[model samples]
Target: MSDAHVSLRDVTKVFPAANGGEGLHALGPVDLDLGKGEFFAVVGPSGCGKSTLLEVIAGLTPASAGTVEFEGWRVDADIPDGIGVVFQEDACFPWLSVEQNIAFGLRKTALAADAKQRRVRDVIDLMGLGDFAKSYPAQLSGGMRQRVCIARTLVTQPRLILLDEPFGALDQQTRLLMGDEVLRLWRQTGATVFLITHALDEATMLADRIAVMSARPGRLIDVVQTNWPRERDSRIVERAEFGAITARLWKTLREESLKTMALKGAGQAAEPA
Candidate 1:
């Protein structure tokens, strides 16, 4: 982990109570080091602070305690320059075409117009969105629109990509296809990817290592190494090892998920009649 691209030391997040109740302990005391140019995924039960962990790592929300460092540099109030983030929600500008939307973030950079155009064009091709360059988000299918969102981030050439269920909204078939697209993009860009997902199959297929978390006060419960070859594609799932890996990931998460559900059920039962 000495050559880690992103390192977290005792990172934790606690949201203060809205009323006079105790603060919600969302995430924490996590110590993980994601290697440079590798794909890592996190899977856990619902309401297990998965998104909170991603926000803290991205510097979008401040951690209540501990520190996050990117390539030895401490992440502070602002998101570091070499990182890009994509969320589950569709963020594409409806009014803008695919190419225009991809170029949006580049406007804040000092790159020349021609350079910006080239960058956008390259990412469009990379994400296989060349056919829909002029199409707006509404004109594209769910998968294509997600590609646009990812392309928009890639156009900026970030060294680290943090994806929080980028394909969460798509159907299963489309989700697997999008996973192929992501694998291609990850190999091509050579950027480190940190993904947060709930799908065991997705995590098993895409990640070099999958981290499973505990219930509400989310902590890393287990880390399963996929040991997938770097040159692999989606077809690898056909292998028996894939099922074993997914089953292992689910095994670690199933207990935590039951815990989460029971806690919710109790909370509901305790509410005033």
Candidate 2:
């Protein structure tokens, strides 16, 4: 991927053990490259270090080994300038209104007040939250709040956006609708999106390519290209190829999941009573 917006080479993360014995090996030895303006996603079983992978790419967490680079710059110890991260949990400021929360990240920028406001307004309209600009997190539904979170990230005009199951808490219908919103955002903003999700359908519908990982001590097992057009929406799921893509993702993921469950059972069986 010559136009790689984000690149990882042999990236791995291991959590130090409190007893100074062994560590919990979470991720990789994985190599991945996300192209500029591409919508890429990662899907894996629970505890497979999917979130760890996202955090490493975002520079929120350091990798024990290997390198992560974004847009030709090595990223270590600090988040790169052109990256934004949205996690599964709600991060909106409780005290701030929708507009204020969205503008919070821009405060430290060199842009003038009018410019900041304009950017915020543009994102608000993009996310379809114009009606709720005055509303707070408590006043919005789950899907709407997630949109607000994404809107906040978009206001900064990041070149790469990393989303960790941002729509995980929403209902199925809401998740599909929010997928459409994300598609619109991706098309309009032309930003590279790196999403980590457990939902095969969502990944199938939204991503240009989907990477599957093995169970903990996570490894990149496969990458499936959706082969959909850049200008696409949730309705594409109704197409035959959508089902085939989702099934392919599931096939690999299910194997990993079963292996994960067997490993967990074996671990429990070996534990002291």
Which ranges of candidate 2 are over 4 A from the true structure?
Answer: none
* Candidate 1 structure quality by residue, lDDT tens digits, 123-168: 8888888889998899888888888889889988899999999989
| lDDT of all predictions | 0.92, 0.91
Candidate 2 global TM-score: 0.97
Model 1, residue 97: C-alpha shift (Å): 1.5
Error (Å) of candidate 2 at residue 61 is 0.6
* Displacement of the residue 173 alpha carbon in candidate 1, Å: 1.0
Model 1 bad stretches (over 4 Å): none
Clashing pairs in 1: none
